[model samples]
Target: MIILPQSIAHVQQLIQPGENYYLVGGAVRDALLNKCNNDLDIICPGGTQKIARRLADQTSGAFYILDKERNTSRVIINESNGDRIVFDFTQLRGGSLEADLRERDFTINAMAVNLTDPVHVIDPLKGGRDLLEKWLRPCSGSSFRDDPLRVIRAIRYSVALDLKMESSTIQELKETVVNLDQISKERKRDEFFKILGRGKTSVSVQLLHSFGILPFLGIENLTNFAKVLQRLRVLDSFMSYLGNDSSLLKRDYFQLASFISGLGKQRKNLSNYLAQPNNSYRTRKDLDHLGAFLWDTSHVDECEVFKKLALSNDESTHLYILLKNRNWLHEFVENGGVLDNRIIFQYFKRLGDAGLDLALLTLADTASVVTAELNHDLWLLELEVCGRLIETWFEHPEVVDPKMLLSGTDLLIEFGLTPGPLIGQLLENLREEQAAGEVLTRQEALDWVEEKKLK
Candidate 1:
């Protein structure tokens, strides 16, 4: 393979022939491991931002200083194929790349592949060795302590890349992991979601449980999380969707809560955890919707937590509203109203996904509490049914909303009746009948109204 550099080329060309410029940190780590590399953070000797900025300007890229304290500037260049190429230039390395490489968090991320003149590596930190070994070893324990978010990053890397944490590093992380509180919540959220978006949020969920680090971040009781993962084998897949698929995430929110809350051992904590983010009061409403669905089904005690989580909202009102949204329950109800074309189209427009997801969520939630009835793979069956419902829903809009048929003018002229209350009522009824597929033509609609003996 040709050791080439679209990234390093820029750095090497800008700096003098034998000058000190090295492709350092994450780019080097990913390159050595043969991972797709585009974002490049270079550890230049000193007095190089001018050179870096000039290169970025020549390439018509954008450059901005991230932090003046760190003297780090980010250059964003767009590739011909519309891919983003980011370059990070920092002056903290003094004149030696080793000084900068050692400051990184993990061994795999601390490797520096030199780009100046003759191509060589300055792995004073052995980051390539650790990368080859599939190890998540920190450059130094105190290195991560300088930035506690790295503690979370370590856990994220383990799940995201399917790499194991070196035993010594895991022990080191636990020792200093508690200091993560020193990091801001926004930073914590950033690092946490990085793992989440990597399609490994569920695995990270499990890893957080294995180590005692999760409790420090406020998820002290993980019994529900642990059980939920085991019961619904697709727990990881479901969590994975949260990263890339927002529709599935929003659709599954209720079910995820219901399933986790169903664990039944310590019902309260799990419910609180679900509702404990972004506008707590309204978030509780989302959870209450899930709670009401499971309240009758499972013996999980969530009323008190619901009260604490909620801020003076009507609980029953919420229950009714959520039930209304979930018209799928109407499928199993005594009278679910007719499942005609009009109603199907209305459902399709209101919710992009079919009623099958709701049914599956409920089943999954029930199985989460106790695997007696839903232990089998019924989700596949639900998927097939939902596929048909979704197709029929999108096909027709007028089928769901009957008022599309006609108005008082059309009815009054056809029946030779004046535009009175009776005319309006008769026209609406005709629309309803048409919506229900009971009337096919204007003559048929008029005949039905006459049969009903409307004035």
Candidate 2:
């Protein structure tokens, strides 16, 4: 009964009459909710892979089998707007469509609709009513026991759809919380990232902590749990302060959420927890910096914690610079040092592209410590100052990079200096002079380098 014109058209083109297939799961729930969800789950009595292949071939999309034993396959249709529509085709889990619905995680997602007759929804469990009521009810009493990962999914769906958990479902979740340990880390990590990806993660974290799931995830200390919550709050507030600015959008806020979630939790190593294979070098660098921020140890470069985390050389260098410069800037701000053009430029130059992220992180950390009653004005002033600096940096990005006037090779060839560490030192001095506006042109830069050599 939903008006998904394009999706319905696609479905009609792919599915013929008499085909034993139905649109199922979240797709149906979202349709009833009047939400446009491109990720559709379809159930078929058989020929799941055939249907997937046909759909992919017809749409010029890509096809892959998600699970061979379960007869599940996927077809991804790339849209003009750069969005992807994923159609997951799977055979019925049990004997019939009704039975398959019974085995679903939540009542709202347990409904189905015939692919041929899209107007009439098949709600075997009155899931449509639960959707109307905005309540999340398990399809069966043993739902959590059926899959402990459903417990996490319940929280995620609750926050995502803005639904409330039924009282009975809440009790069932509490009773079956211990079974989460039986689930694989990969599944748990996937669900956890989904929750973080939705943003507004503090409530979910609090719910997990209250449900005794944090302990299973390695967070046992109550004090550290409070710190984690504080960090999330700070992050939320800082993101709000950024408003419509899109510069921070390129950074993975989901990873930030994940990092904040594990800040207080004890873990074996950062690499094992992240488990993001095939990540770009920038992503790894960002993760390493985030890990260092969470570790919060003195001498981050030499910290045993980082050593055991198994970061790459580039990741380690980025983390070291981020931590060292962040600490310096934080101390400067705490000591009431003036945030003039010179100081801001110095911090930005030292931090490079990570300067803004570090500034936001510093503000969040400061906000986490400031009490409502004491030094509240100081906290507000600090936030304003940081915001201004970030805005100014974005408006005038030349301060950050400052068009390097001289390279190390240039220093060697122009100054007739031998290939040694002193060339690097001279280039560093030249960059500092350029950033400080002492040397504006190439000639001035050469003069400055020559003058430094005389010194």
Candidate 3:
């Protein structure tokens, strides 16, 4: 009777006054950890469904039945006490605390605390030790064998909590990592991104590499996980810009890779625009940008590899342009070699994050190939740049202009040239210049473009 919520007087009324109630699972685990806990699974001494039905009747809660063979049912009560509370009604643990703990995933997750005063803790498995040591170990490898997703979960938690998985558990992962496909992609995606969102995506990726677990997914052929960590702060900050704040970097890789890929498509398209269809120069130029990304890394720079990695036409084009134009030291010197919000946002607006990702990877690549003696100041500058980029995307989304102030038609008529594509490019560049505060109005833009064309 005590298990019934205060609002459900009717359910409490229906109870002939003899049932006992106790808390269970994650709620208790969080309580034990002194972490904020919201899950409210409850164990009822008798007729779990009847308790559920009565509660549902009183509170509009839904009743769900589970494992009819086990005669178990769940009463889902969702209460909005300024926060969501799910009262999961279940039959008492089928066996002793030890047996109940044995049925769970990891040892640390198995422990639960009673909400009753004195806050009695139930630890039939040695979960307390694991939690204290910040270690992750499954109740048994058989549990993981039954459900292989736990393998990734361990890796994910290790990255998230900045902890490590126990040796025995790592062995279990190695055995199960290849069989991960048995699990649903939706589930795998969920787990994979959870690691990413933790700002430990690179860590999880690296571990995946270390254990040879990534080949299971087509996105393997990754170089290093530790490198991802080294690049984490910079990558995350830039991704945050675009109002797509994410710990997991969960946007479609193709969408992002397209944004990042610059050199190859740039040459193909750029050459076509320049009326240089016969020249192989653009292709070599594209390879050179890949070389920029690879210049400081160990791997031999290959143009095909860049093509494979590119996510989109735009990304390929821009990356190609920026790589060939890079004079980071020159840009750094002009800006006093100290990174700030204006500098970061300017780069983000000009190059987008993919180019910056390459910039970040360059540092890591250099260390792997050359020296670990990084300029700490450069690292701070990178992080500051990341924060600035993130802040700008959130603050200002790129809205479409109502109408362009100038046009290619105007350029063609005024300048006495054929109505060619460069006119459009000229107008677009003018708009960008105006947008960037380099010019203020159509008159100023026209004057600037007219002067440039006459040259």
Candidate 4:
């Protein structure tokens, strides 16, 4: 049932008689599995850049030289619907194509299909059989030793594709797990985020934990492992239903199901909130899982841990605020406090947009502690606090982010004051006043600041 993708056929027509070009790696494997793969990997023995440039010109795609040392180039064809088709052209390693396939990381990724003759596959490592058998195997004995990052990729591919690693592969991964620290933080971070980007985050993370990969990433000592698993499940379910996809919800997760269903119409708001991208490849949902994973009932230096993972400052800051205030909303509800515009304003004031993510995280944390008996009243209280806060964030935008009624210059000029910390403090207080519905106009804002200065 091997069906070549349309992109492959398109490239086949452009192939000249003498060109020694072949489609290799995941693109070939995905084609054999009848999957839709937009990223294609093509190998050229000597003239990778020339072939890449020619393909880019023929297809009217943008071109970039990815690695000059290895002679790797990329062609990106931007589709009308905002999707991109990527073709990576790399210089084939080893002397011949079979040697090149043998040098790859895994059997499943070592297959190739010549562009000139697109019908037959060149699986030198019996990758086609492994694909049929629904198991993972290394292309060679030294696969993991060559690049320890493959250890993480092995777990990711297993969980993502529902394939089991062979017994010997598992043994080798455990032996070389320590060497993962030698890989660059950026590379490890990239592969880890790819795992997060795929769904079933809890399953993937547990596998990483079992395979002893989380320690190197600085997230191994997660407090209360069982409860952490529950929190992850609840968080994943929230991301799913809120993002308008309910397939991730499981039947055993009654509390999560009920909690999400209780959000009612605010589900759409949370969906849009969680859909915000941290970068080109990551979204707020990914951060939610990271928060759930690193969250400790006690305390841990989350910023330092994120630094160890080489996460971007923006991501680290968001997760820091998330874990720091993980219990704020829950304690508020437990202490019999009701949510209002003023409280909501202060919450967002402290956490900014992360306040919404915190609300979801708190909800998941709260749901994880409850049992099957399900205290109806307690669940209701937590839901009301979380739902109303989320509702205000999306329904009443002015409450979370109020328009500035007065500027710093207005304070310095109108009040005849120096531009010190007082001006900044007064401006911040003015925003709180605006959110509280106390200052409605520029004149009112000015008078409010004047009145505050006198105090």
Per-residue C-alpha lDDT of model 4 across residues 145-252, encoded as one tens digit per residue: 999999999998888777888788899999999999899988888888888735788798888888889878866556689888777877877777777666787644
lDDT of 3 by residue, 41-160 (tens): 665666577767776777777677865666566555556664333456666665555576677788777865433322456777777777778887788759788788887777776766
- Candidate lDDT scores, in order, read 0.55, 0.66, 0.52, 0.81
- Return the TM-score for each candidate structure: 0.60, 0.76, 0.49, 0.88
Q: How many clashing pairs does model 1 include?
A: 3
- What residue runs in model 3 are displaced by over 4 Å at the alpha carbon? 1-23, 37-100, 114-118, 133-137, 157-173, 197-207, 224-229, 232-430, 438-455
- Evaluated with lDDT, which candidate comes out highest? 4
- Between candidates 2 and 3, the one scoring higher on lDDT is 2
How many clashes show up in model 3?
15
* Candidate 4 local Cα displacement, residue 152, angstroms: 1.7
The residue ranges of model 4 lying beyond 4 angstroms of the native Cα positions read 1-17, 53-64, 75-78, 264-269, 297-299, 412-418
- For model 4, name the residue pairs that clash: none
Q: What are the per-model C-alpha RMSD values against the true structure?
A: 10.4, 8.1, 13.2, 2.9
Error of 1 at 331 (Å): 8.1
- Model 1 weakest 10-residue run by lDDT: 291-300
Ranking by TM-score: 4, 2, 1, 3
Better of 2 and 3 by TM-score: 2
